[model samples]
Every structure is written in structure tokens, then in C-alpha cells.
Target chain A: MKLDLYKEHAAEYKAVKKPIFVNAAPAQYLAVDGQGEPGGECFEQCVGALYAMAFTIKMTLKAKGQDYAVSKLEALWYPPDGGADFETAPKSEWRWKLMIRTPDFVGKQDLREAVKALQRRGKNANAGQVTLEKLHEGECVQMLHVGPYEQLCETITAMLAFAEANQRRQHGLHHEVYLSDPRRVPPERLKTLLRQPVRKA
Target chain B: MRDRTRHSYEQRILRVLTHIQQHLDGPLELDALAGLACFSPYHFHRVFTGMIGEGLMEHVRRLRLERAAQRLKQSRRAIADIALEAGYGSHEAFTRAFRERFGAAPSAFRRRHAPLPVPDGRAVHYTPDQVIRFSPKRSSRSMSVAIRTIRPQRVAFVRHVGPYDAVGEAWERLMARAAPMGLLGESCQFIGVCYDDPEITPPERIRYDACIAVSGPIRPRRDLGVQVIAGGDYAVTTHFGPYQRLGRTYARLCGPWAARSGRELRAAPSFEVYLNSPEGTEPGDLLTDIYLPLMPAPGTE
Candidate 1:
């Protein structure tokens, strides 16, 4: 879990918190919450779902001469009260949010155009409503972690403490960049990059 | 027909040389090697010499003696066994060849070349370690990659025997034919596949393929047929140099990096994908991406 993705995409992760308006097509993803412990099973499901959506977007856009950037990705975890063992609970819930930016994000006009093209091909195309949001850019500390997702809590805590002691405030939600495809990589050797945007306090 | 079979004969000789190195202590003769190549001894010697640029017997003799010299200084094997395994009739004959090649007799060489002990008491037995420590570090910290999984390809190939420099003409012919088929493309890198293990393959019989990827299911046309290149995870590194220097880069990346990272190298064929042609760039400026397959080590979490 040595976060090979971050090492490979260091430049992209380093340029965070800058507002970049993006017009992205609608994508389907399995939303997950990050309130509870992030285990191996939870991470595998989350990444697999995200990759499928991203690949579909890339392929769809490439066919239409459009490029998009993954602007924001965050997982909201819902742990039980008192930080109880959610694993033993009857049901665990997670929510995953991804904001992808394309070249045109002014309004629903771009979405209507895409929907029209898909309808012509006789496909169930929902060019969902589009909105423009500010994507903040700034400096951030990142590390590649190779291990079970549950084990990452300790590392994340350490990183947060480091950031706090250094007078840097956490500016945005946390995001994990998937490097090795979970199917190809073993649970033990899976690599994910933990990136948290920060600004000078 | 003889011309068509010549390439196959060369490959057989290289494989035989690899086998000989693995069993250096066993008997190896021209007849035995000819049998392995499925050719008569009369034709075997001629074809081997023509492709490898040395007489078959002479090359084997030199390689065996060279390995003996290394073993003598590196290991505590009895000198008599080393001599016998080198195919020498006596210790005296082995010592003579050792001195001729290495400029020192076996006993004298061993005394002067005893391995140095590190602080942990492990002997530093390999010369490459010392060389790597002194080599300049790469300025860039990035690795190049082409995000594509190439399907299995059938190649019409010619195995080059001996040092790579002597086999340039043969490769030129292979590349010429492959190019017309549109088998070589920008996305598909031209590959030179090395099959023989360096430790065992004699220098005279090292095997290499000058190959390009083909478009479809290959039908054996004339003496050409298809061989599948399996798909898997590969550790890719780009090297900018003449083809002759590729082996050094591979030795550095695979031999050292894989060893240090505690990863096991899979038995898949490691190859160099040529990014630029000799016509487009000078030989020294050619770019080649070297791919080494890797797998997880046993019992590692």
C-alpha cells in the first residue's frame, strides 16, 4: 500500500484548493460514507465503483472530444455513537461524493446537449443537471499507504497531528487516490494515496 | 531449405549453451550438442561458427575456464574439481587457460581476490555492487509508461548468436521484413527478447530475438510462425542508449532493484521495446523501454 498513485501523480495532488470551474458529464458511482472504520472490503467496493464510473466518463468524453478532471472526491463515514464497533452493527452506511470538471459548466445547456446525443442513439441517457462549483487549490501533504484500510486510521491520525503542529489547517475533505487495481493487487499490498488539502494557519 | 532452417539451428545452439552452463560439471561434446539441435555434427559446427563468430569447441573452452576462474576465487571448491568441471584433462591445463584469460594463475588469483567481509560478516562477492555504488544517480525521478495491455503476438524472428555487435546484419533483415507488414508501430515497441540466463549461457551462444508485434492470429508462412507473448504486470524502465548498452541497464534495474525490494522476478521473457529507430536517431540516442515482470515474494504480508 505504498501509495504509488501519489508518487506517480505528485504534481496533480500538490496543486489543490484552486477554484477551477468544470463541466462534467453525469457518472454513476456507489456512494459510501466514511464515518466508520475503513476496512479492506469497504475500500475494495468503493474503488471498484469509482474506477468503473471514471473509466466510463473517460471513454465517453474521449469519443466526444472533451476532457474532464476529477475535481473533488470525498467519503462521509457514519460511525455509531461513542465510536462503537460499527463492524458488529446490523447495518453500516457510507456515502461517496465525486465532482468531475469538464470544459463547460455554465448551466444545464451542456447536459441537455449530451442527453440529446444519447437519446438519438436510443440509449437511456440521463444527462443529469449540471452546476458550477469552486474547486479550491493549494499545498497538501500526501503519503502512499500499503496495508489494510483499517490500519490507515493510525497513519491518518499521525499525519493530522503533524499538520496541526506545523501550523497548517486542513482546508478540505480527505480523498484517497487508488493506484493499483484492487482486483490485480492483493489486499495486503494494495496501494492508496491519502491526500488532505492544507493552508497556512 | 537449408537457409530456412539456419535460424532454428542457431537458436538450438544457444539453448544448448545454456544447458551446458547449468550442468557445467557434466559431459558436453559436439555430438551431444548436435543431437540437441537435431542437426548432424558436420552442419552443427559450421552453422555455430557462422552465427557465433567463433569455433564451437574454442568458445566452450573459454567460457568454462572463465567460470572456473570466478569459482576459484569466490568459492572454496577444491582446485581439482574446478579443473575437471571446466573440461580440462588436468589441473595444469585448467590453470594455463585461467592465466591466459585472466592474466593470473588460479591459485595466485584466488589469494589476491579473496572476497572482502562487510561489517555483518557477509562477503561482498559481486563486482556489480561496487560499480553501482559509484555510478551517477539518474537526474529525473520519473518512470515512463504506456497504458495499454498488448495482446499476444506471433513473431517471425531470427535468433542472434554471440555478442550483439556481430549480429546486426541478421537483425536488419528481420526488421526489414517486419516493417512491411506494419507489425512495428509507435504504440507497439519493437522488442529484443533475451532467453538465455546470463549465469549459464556462454557468451558465444547467448540467444536474442529481433521481433515486432503482429496484427492478427499468425499463420506460419514460409519458415515463420507465431509465438505468444504472455500478459502480466511489468516493471517498466526506459533506457536511452545503443542496443549494446541495454543489458547493463537491465542488469542494474532488475538484478539490484528487484533484489533489494524483496520481489521475485517471474520467468516471463524480459524484453526491450525500442521507441526510436536507428534511422530516426543515432544509435547512442535510441530510447528503449525495458520491461521486467514481477511477483510478490513468498510469505510476505
Candidate 2:
């Protein structure tokens, strides 16, 4: 049977309309780092390279009779200057790490081979930009926002207030776990898990 | 043709392993191991984890314990001295760790002359003077794939356009800016956005972002910029273990999984959401969620 990460860690993926706290477990990822607005030329190119490498890896493993369902697209976002509030920062100064989660068994050799494959194909010039990353957000306050992107501000405010009332303070980057396909689903019906790692104030 | 790169890495790792066996009492810093293996310190830990099926420190600690076990069977030295040599501060701590690994206390094991413990597929165990032999593990983990719709998010970020290993300064700068502004909250997520390939792009030209999700409209500053991540459907996978070993997972997804899923690629940047931080977590226990944008099916267009 194929591995489904979402189903395996249902708690992490599951969220509600109201903000709630949960202790997240550890996981791994295929990551690429970049600086710029998310939909710009550089961001587009980076995403393209990232997928190219991801497919190369998938295909190689399939040949060896190992198959898995490729998971979701998640990102960690932050601003350069600490003095600049994350919510208020300009897009030009934004830095982000775009990622795809991979299984635990993937090793460095697999990465080397995939990189070599991409280089040999000479198709994705940015494939080498892909790297592995791991995160273990312990405690977080998360809420599901089922509306357009512009409406997230209100949800975030409520979520932050909820966290504040719970005696927790934001301690890490703001995290989003997208559960809907914006390409297929209308913005009004988009499903996003707005999560924030927190600590006791 | 078979890749020569694998062999080169194996050789480098083997050299380190042999050195570890010989220098059981010496300080084995991560930088020193990376130097010995000719790998960047930033990426070396993962590389070691991938090739060795264990983290560097973990491997070292195991070796030291195994060697101590050998000495217990053969030597008459004080258990305290042996424990000290094994890097434990006290005999009690050594005894606990030893009992956990060998299934008996050191003194009991010495009296019993127990048989060698079963190999955990690594096939490498400590031997006094013999060269360490290694057998690369062939285990591959299965992954689950899901097509998700990501909502556009506004994030504040700092740019680090260089080698992945050198991106620490960017994170430090970002945190330095974030902590003072009360942006360091319980709900914030740390993220990195990669824009270029290290092998193809000049190290100085590679683009990376250190980012945090922000709520409410905030003014953009000279150093920190905010932007919305475009919302779209994406293929995602969750990876468990150290970040360095993600290459294998990427290969699997991009290769067989993509081909089999019958999904076309979307022309957008992929990103990672760190579900947890690394400072307090073990390397093996860290979790990262990876995202890749996907094109809508042909009929939907």
C-alpha cells in the first residue's frame, strides 16, 4: 500500500474554524530557500526547479519498487528585519522557504542521484537548489480559514487573540497548511490552516 | 552509467568512520568530521545521516560504547576510567546507557562474557585495531501524496542568496529582527524559500529567503519585505528525519510519484513549513512539510 502522510498524521493536518493548540510531531522536507514576493519571476522559477527535482526523485524510487503519494506544498515565511513586523513588512523584503515533505527513508545518496539525473537531463537548471530540511514545531495555535486570501487577516487576528487569551505567545514564523486547491476551488471556499508556533508568555 | 559520486561519498564517510574508531577518546566535533569528509558543515550532518544510517554524534557515541563493551570483556581497568574514556561524566550514567544498549550493566556483562549483540543492519561494530567495514543500507521509506490548495499568505522575509550551508546568518538576522518586535509569538512558522540550484548557479547568485508568517497589514520596512504567497493546488509530502536526507525523498516524488500520479507540474516555487524548530528537537525527530505546486488537470482548464 502507498504511504499517505496526511492520513498518517491526521492531527497535524486537521484544523477547525476556531484557534486551538496542539503539540506537533517532527517531520522532514525537501526545501528551497528564496527571497522575494511569492508570485514573482524568481519565485516561479524556484518552484519549477523544486518540482523538477521532486519528480526526478519520485521516478527513481519507483524504479526500485518503492512508491509513495507525494504530499503537500507548505512554506515557512519571515521578514529580514526583526524590527519589521512580519505582517507589516513589504513584499520586496520578504524571505520564504518553499517545501515538499518527503518520507523518512530518503537519504543523501538519493539526493545526489537525483541531482545527477537532473544535471544529465539538463532540463532543470535550478534542481540543485533543492535541499533537505527538518522541523519540529512543538506547540502551536492553529485555525482553519475557509475563505479568500484577503480574509485571512481577520482570522489571524482572532487566532492571535485566542492564543493570547490562552497565555501563549508567538515564538516562531507563521505557518500555513493549505488543504484546498486554489486552482480548482474558488477563493471563497479555500481551506487553509493558519498555524503559529508558540511558547508560554 | 553508475554514479561515481556515491563511491566518493562512501569513501569519505568510511575514512571518518575509521578515524572515529581509532580516536575514541578524542573530541569529535561536527566541523572536524565535515572537514575530514570534505563536506560543508551545514550539510554534513544530513549527508552523514544518509550515508551512515545514523547521525555523526550518534554513530560516535555508539562506537565508544561498543569499544567500552569490548574492553569490559577483555581488560581489568577500573569501570570509572572506562566510563570516563567513553565520554560519560559518571559511572552511573555510563551504566545506564550501557544497560540500555547491551541489555545488562557493564559489570554484569564483564562477568558474563556475553556474546556480540545482533547487528542492526549497519554491519559495523567496534574492533580494537581492525579497519571498520561498512555496508550501505538500502531501506527506502514509502510516502503518501496529496494535492492541496494553498491559500495566498503574506510573509515578512530576509534574503539569503548563497550556499545553503551559509544561510545561518540570514536566520540569525531574521530572528534578531523578529524577537524585538514581538513577532516572535507562539504561532509563527519559520520558512526558507530557495530560488537557484547550487550546482548550476553561482553560490553568490543563489537566492534564499528567511521568512515568518505575519498577520494583519504591516508596513514594509527597508530590510524586511512582506508579500502574499499565491494560493494554488500543490502536491505535498511530509518528511521525517534530518533535513539533509530530503534529497532521496525529492527524487522519489519527482520521479516515480509524479509520473504515476498523472499530474502536470505547476510553474511556481515550492516551499517548506517547519512544523517544529530544531534547537530543542533531536535531528531524527524533526519534521518538515514540503509543498510543490501542481497544474490543474487538463479538463479543468
**Top model by DockQ, which number?**
2
Give the per-residue Cα lDDT of candidate 2 at A192: 85
Give the lowest summed-lDDT range of ten residues in model 2 chain B: B178-187
Q: Which stretches of candidate 1 lie over 4 Å from their true place?
A: A1-201, B1-93, B96-163, B182-188, B202-205, B296-301
lDDT of candidate 2 over A1-201, digit per residue (tens):
767777788888768899888887888888888988867877877777666566556646654667666666777877468788656888778888888888888777877777775555344567788898888989999899999977888998998899889899989888877676564457898988888999999
Write the residue-wise lDDT of candidate 1 on B1-301 in tens digits: 3333333443565566565556555667666776786544434443344344445566567657766776787789988898887888888888888888777788888798455323222211123122211111221333344323445555657667775566565565564444333333223346777765433457788777777565544455543445666675566778877877765556455433433334444546677777655532457667788776654334533
B1-301, model 2: which lDDT tens digit per residue? 1234456656777888888888879987777876897755544554566566665677788889998988888889999989998999999999999999999999999899567676665557787876677865444656688889878887888888887778777876675555434344333567777655453456888788888887655566777788777787877887777888665665455434544455655545667777755643557767777776666765777
Model 2 stretches astray by more than 4 angstroms:
A80-82, B1-301
lDDT of 1 at A163: 78
Q: What is the DockQ of each candidate?
A: 0.01, 0.02
What 10-residue stretch in candidate 1 chain A is worst by lDDT? A16-25
